[model samples]
Target: MRTRTTTAALIVAGLLLTLTACGEDDTAAKPSAPPSLTDEQRSSARAAAGLPPEPSTTARYKFLEALNDIDRRIVDGKDDKAVSRGLNQCSSIKRASGDEDKQVELVKQTLSRFTIDTRLPDIATPETGGEILAAVHQNLCPDF
Candidate 1:
């Protein structure tokens, strides 16, 4: 019984040491900065707006790229996981501070390019989605 207890104690100590060692590696590693906007990102958002690049274009572009990745996964007929991932990406951007509404409007405008049949199911809501889109439209095409 003493031998068995010693072995168990060693095992527990080994686990604790292993966990401690693993944590130190992360401490040494630097946290990555957010990605900058690629040329494709700027073009896509601009395409949707039919206007010149805006001030928040880079940050906006990165947000859109994340959502686009989710969208590409969905278009490939991946599964509900892909669709759900897209929804979550949208939610993340909408939830972010500092011009979230503008980002949301960019998303709506991008989706508008797709045919009604090709679009995501109820992509924007009457409140969050519609309001943002309306503001974008009001600025871009106020003649309407």
Candidate 2:
């Protein structure tokens, strides 16, 4: 009886393990790239804002760096570099308007103490890495 019970238990356990293993795939893929915003969408946003269109990523990053400097100034209770940087960031946005351009403006306004608040849509939840991480997430991360 003991032997039969042990065999039954082992067989049931083996079957369950096989079923679980069968459900997963080692070849499961990562997500595909997100869709790019359409040119019409970009054009409409630019028209509404009376701005030009999107600038290069490099220009965007430099502007974001300047904006973050503004935040550091705020934390120090003095609006020094942040104001300058934030305004510079906004200047960079003058030639662009769309999702990406909107994001650029959001960064500028956030650090510039504007009445109209805007934030980037896809910010990764903040951790303790400090300003550099914040900048990278804001500037480099897609849609950040």
Candidate 3:
């Protein structure tokens, strides 16, 4: 009886130590924030926008890159999957914009403007999928 109790206590102690060590490693491995853009990149982005240079321009460029990436994916034939991802990206931009109606209006206007590019494969043209992605980039990166 004494030996069994000691073994049980040792097992419990080992489990507790393992759990504590696992949690500490996870916390240490947490990802750091994204790095800021260099001065040259920021200046070029501002020049392209034809606006004054500012720290926020970096973020705007990053945001535009994200939107464009989705557009590329859509054009690459990912179709619905790209649309789903783009919508999520748009939601983040909309939240940042604090103008849901304006964003929606811009998206609608872009969709109306671009139509589907017929050069793409039929699988890449899902009703208004092409237009929707164009709309997303337009609304998200109006400056660009």
Candidate 4:
């Protein structure tokens, strides 16, 4: 009787192990790329997050062109960085809530932070910084 009970226990344990192994999804262990969102979905997401709609491809190209014109170093092999900084500036502008003075200050700070001269302790000059701000506003976040 004891031998029979031990066999039954072993069978139950084996069955449980087999069931647990089968229940696992092999695909779950592998990483998959995220689904691409449609333009409408992206717009809705931006709206829900309180961010302005994304700039058009043409607008982005123009923005990069303007940045390149202002100072090649700003976009030279750093296009992504420049674009990110502009977007951050736009967010700052929104937070400023139409305070022109605050917006200007924020732009200046952003320019200084991004375009600071490595050798010198100086930031971008007022003219260049103003151009950067203008490009960002006109292209990336005109509504803001």
RMSD of each: 14.6, 12.5, 13.9, 6.7
> For model 2, how does the per-residue alpha-carbon lDDT over 1-144 read when each residue is reduced to its tens digit?
999999999999999999999888765575778888699987787556544335455745564554446453233433334334433344344444356756544454543343222333232112212333344334433242
List where candidate 1 sits over 4 angstroms from the true fold.
23-25, 34-51, 55-112, 119-144
Model 3 misplaced regions, further than 4 Å: 22-28, 38-40, 43-144
Better of 1 and 2 by TM-score: 1
- Give me candidate 2's TM-score against the actual structure: 0.26
Q: Is candidate 2 or candidate 3 better by lDDT?
A: 3
Q: Order the candidates by lDDT, highest first.
A: 4, 3, 2, 1
- Ranked by TM-score, the better of candidates 2 and 3 is 3
Q: What is the lDDT of residue 121 in candidate 1?
A: 58
Residue 140 of model 4: what lDDT? 89
How does model 4 score by TM-score? 0.63
Candidate 4: regions farther than 4 A off: 1-28, 31-38, 112-123
lDDT of each: 0.46, 0.47, 0.51, 0.77
> What's model 1's TM-score?
0.30
Residue-level lDDT tens digits of model 4 in 5-61 = 999999999999999998887997889999999989998987766577767789889
Clashes of each: 0, 2, 0, 0
Least accurate stretch of 10 residues (summed lDDT) in model 1?
A: 135-144
Clashes, model 2: 2
Clashing residue pairs, candidate 2? 53-96, 70-82
Selected candidate, larger lDDT, 1 vs 2:
2
Candidate number that wins on lDDT, 2 or 4 = 4
lDDT of 3 by residue, 1-144 (tens): 999999999999999998897766566577898999998997797465444334244544454454456455333554434344444445444444667676555554334333334433442343345455455545443543
